[model samples]
Target: MCLSFHSFRKLIASVLFLTFFFTGCKNSEKRTVKTEEITFIKEGELSIYKPGTDVPVLNLNIELAETDYETQTGLMYRTSMKENEAMLFIFDDVAMHSFYMKNTEFPLDILFIKEDMTIGSFQENAQPLDEGSLSSKVPVQYVLEVNAGIVAEKGLSIGDSISFQKL
Candidate 1:
């Protein structure tokens, strides 16, 4: 069929518009994967011992986040942490520490430890994805994040001490 310039241009534009519109709708359709799968992270082990003695209670595989960037992004997108796993945050000075659970996918129990190696405070069973700040009532140099309820399961207390070695 012979067509004029205007009809040809309009046909071409209509075809392009329909192609893009259908393509966009297809991309927006429900995806097969409901949630993004996250990989588990393990870097080392941290042993939590008795309050004052060296007697060991339990050892947790841990991922250490020492630098400023790592500390800021701690466990934000993880789907879960093993019962025997934890994340440790190290800082230079003993100061009040605060934590929030934005983008976190699972609950955690945060342990705040003083420079002298004693547990100074705890934020237990912190809900996942919460932005509320969890605090160390006293100044602390280290912070530990573990699967929620691990502390109570092991009967951990305020004075419990930890010893860790990197893998």
Candidate 2:
């Protein structure tokens, strides 16, 4: 077939554009990732005790958040936690600390613990995904997160104490 030079160049350009477009789309499809749910990892055990008591009021399988990244990402993106499971954040400094639900998917009760292992303050029934600051309102070295309503259910109080051991 006889064709003009300009027409031949236009045909080549169109062919190249379509080829690139389809190839790009196919590559993107292959790159699509299926997100899986994050599961809990047991790292320790914690016990909460009543004031001046030797026996524990509650015991929990805990996931420790000791690193900067672990503390910052605490419970985020998890759908839910078991009633017996909790996340304990260990900070190096004893100072006023605060938390928020942010990307957390379930309600929680946050306990603020002093260096002496006593509960200093707590925020109960923190709403899921709320970005509002849930402050300790006191200096604390540890923060414990558990399923909402656990504090009241366990009869936990400010003077209650905690002891933990890593697995």
Candidate 3:
């Protein structure tokens, strides 16, 4: 086929443009992914006390994860947690809550608490990045995620009550 010089140049330009566009979309592995730094803020102090006693079972500087987004992102990217640091997840009603360690970088002990703030159940030593469903087994209104072994270290039991104050 015979074509004018301008027409031939236009065809070449169009072909080059489409070639680069398709190739760019296919190279997903070369894409630059931007990851933001996750910040840890001590928003409150929570104390887990022995039931019916004034003695403290454990005290933690906590980050409150009450909203849907906050609760979903609870400690997922944290590399380390202070022995006295924790994340508290608050729900709107009392119900069974299941948690997994997806994207979590450190192990944790998840304490499921009843409506009255007493611990209902515990998921111990949840491994980092494990997608296993750690259910409360009973209805709960609150969840406390602390460093693994904190419960055993403090001798904390299911019936221990927790109280918190915002800072």
Task: Judging by TM-score against the true structure, name the best candidate.
Answer: 1
TM-score of 3: 0.78
Instruction: Note the Cα lDDT for every prediction shown.
Output: 0.89, 0.95, 0.91
Against the hidden reference, what TM-scores do the models get?
A: 0.82, 0.81, 0.78
**Model 3 clashing residue pairs (backbone):** none
Q: Model 1, residue 134: displacement in angstroms?
A: 0.6
Query: Candidate 3 lDDT, tens digit per residue, 63-109?
Result: 99999999898888768888888999989999999999999999999
Question: Where does candidate 2 stray beyond 4 Å?
Answer: 1-33
Per-residue alpha-carbon lDDT of model 1 for 1-167, expressed as tens digits? Answer: 99999999999999999999999889888556566766556778788888557678988888998999999999998888778878899999889999999999899999999998889999899999999989899999999999999889989999888888887
lDDT of 1: 0.89
Q: Judged by lDDT against the true structure, how good is candidate 2? A: 0.95
lDDT (Cα, tens digit) per residue for candidate 2, span 74-98 = 9999999999999999999999999
